[model samples]
Target: MSWFGFGFNAFGQISGRDRDGNDGDTSIVYTPTEIKCHVDEKSEKSSELRASWSRRASLHLNGGRSLCLAGSNSPSGICDTGCTDAVVGESFVILVFPDRFESWDLDSDEKIPIWSMDVKTLCDGAGSPFNLPLIPGGYIAMTPPFYRPLSPHLKATRLALGAKHSVLLSASGAVYTWGLGSHGQLGHGSLSSEGQPKVVEALWGMRMIFVATGGWHTACISDGGDLYVWGWNESGQLGLPSRAVRKAPKYQTSEETVVTDLPTCGAQPEGEKDTQVFISIQSFPALVDITPSSELKTVGCGSRHTAAVTRAGDLYTWGWGQYGQLGYETSRSDEPYLVEFFRERQLRVVDVTCGAWNTFVSVVKKEVATS
Candidate 1:
């Protein structure tokens, strides 16, 4: 008998494990060619596994619609989509291992060719793939007209993979958004969703370093260390006081009541003299510049929760904890709270990742000194 396993690494590398726990020496590094092959193979295998499990799990779970892994597997080095199939739609979710991409459709149980171009073709000037999987109940939508052209010198680097929603940072420090803008996550000054990518006029030339999107809400970090949030604030997830959701982006000033409107301060250019504010909100805002400060280095967002890692090797989390996703043995909350499990430890955290509910972090142990 042979044991088989599939996993993904922090650097977006995926691998397969056979009975011997060794499978072809890590799949030829992380190049475009190897990545495509890895993804295709994984997607095929995962689709087959899901088809088999859907039959057994649905019967046992009782009224269970489907199964989905719904978490990031990159850092854990383990990739599994579980099983997902429901009357609303009959489709099997496929993840091409190691490629860090996924595909699905309503018609068939087998995986389909969502992308025509291979990795090499995409990397060159050929074209890119469109593999955005549809969210369960969400429908296809588009955003209103808003445009900001990129600098002629900065060629558009097409997306290597297709995502229903993506946070794109341009070379000129602007953030371009597209896909599923209904929740105002696109930051296009409206609630309409968009199929094609559009430049966020609000963040035009702002030198945004990072951007993140939750189911509906969006968050971003400026190069100046200030944090901005917009979209759904129903649970005070925007770190704002009001319950009303805003259709445009707003800056988070302090730890005030739940905010629902745009920030009092407008978007400022990069070199402006502004007080630095670090406001952590539910879901991924943009990637923050953690270099200047020695406290934290990386951060990530889950469906309704957020996580961050400090340079000193500490981890913190806030928001919904229903599934023990916060790594704290407690119930969910509406306020941001520190995860006590890693408060005083000196572990060296190398990476962090999040899924809709679960969080994964990689760390290296410190060597102890002996007399």
Candidate 2:
């Protein structure tokens, strides 16, 4: 799949610059632009666009395919082959091989000989801050010899961790959340923290297929492709109404398609249909509408932004754009809007991944429909 990236690239991470063979380019990509895989080390698998603080990496089933585009890792023998899985964090990178796992510190460029063991595969935990090996009780400084699974079995299909909260999607299409919920991210219609994994009652009975958590927000997708978001909207990350977004400078709207709405989380007070419910924080899972004619294919979240691909191959983004993480180069957006770069180029977006401050998309040429 073709790749396009936009947002923070201070260290050439998103640009993949030097290795990408482009010089004299700025660090931040103001808009969605094409980017090529420029691994210093050869990888057997296709590139999986990933971004971390001041760096970028591409991983595959082989593990740690390319930790850093032009950084060191080749000298180490573990990544050469036989690695089964990998996990990337803000400050370091970890690779899990059948016989051992190695950790690398990106900041110090230190080669740390970590745990050694023969393992089959690493279970994915979340979308960003990359996925770490998780245990029943999180916040552990180290991995225990034998970890315990969730009590009485959770039968979870996916697990996502936010800054202070955790979200779980059960195999039965139910969404469960626990930990910090002061921001209404738990979607229980309140800001009360849940001691145990509590099912989001507001979304009960809906067959949710996917779930994600941001810094203080939670989002999910129903099997039928409806998108639901909640929690903090301080920066409009929830796609709900935002005061910051409404105050965006006029320049940001000069030539962009900006969608604006009353700050409401899909509610109308009794006999107040015309009265918009101003919402700076969504206390429950609020249904968000993007592509009217089609359903969402997939969705992802950044630290303060959200993105999704529609079944019709269109990409939409909302929330913080100070670093251009929204892909539209606007300051901030309270509602979802198309990333016109792809539409103007006739590229059809199929997938998207959000970093702490960057966004990556997988695309292909749009199929031409004819009589």
CA lDDT of every candidate:
0.39, 0.68
Tens digits of per-residue lDDT, candidate 2, 28-124, equal 7776767654543354433455444455555543334333332233233333344444545555556655444566554563455443444334344
RMSD of 1: 14.0
True-vs-predicted CA distance for residue 272, candidate 2, Å: 9.1
Q: Write down the lDDT that model 1 would get.
A: 0.39
lDDT of 1 at 235: 44
**Clash count for each candidate, listed in order shown:** 25, 0
How far out, in Å, is residue 5 in model 2?
A: 1.2
lDDT of 1 by residue, 1-371 (tens): 11111122222222323224554434212111111223232332221111111111110111221223311221111223322221111132333322233333323333452322112222221211221222111211112111123344333332111124655555566766676655556667666777666777766667666555555566665666455565554543454432322222257345433333332323433543353322222222332222355354555555555565665666655555555546655444434455544443535555454544445555556556899
**Number of clashes found in candidate 2:** 0
Off by over 4 Å in 1: 1-116, 121-164, 224-226, 242-296, 333-335, 343-345, 366-371
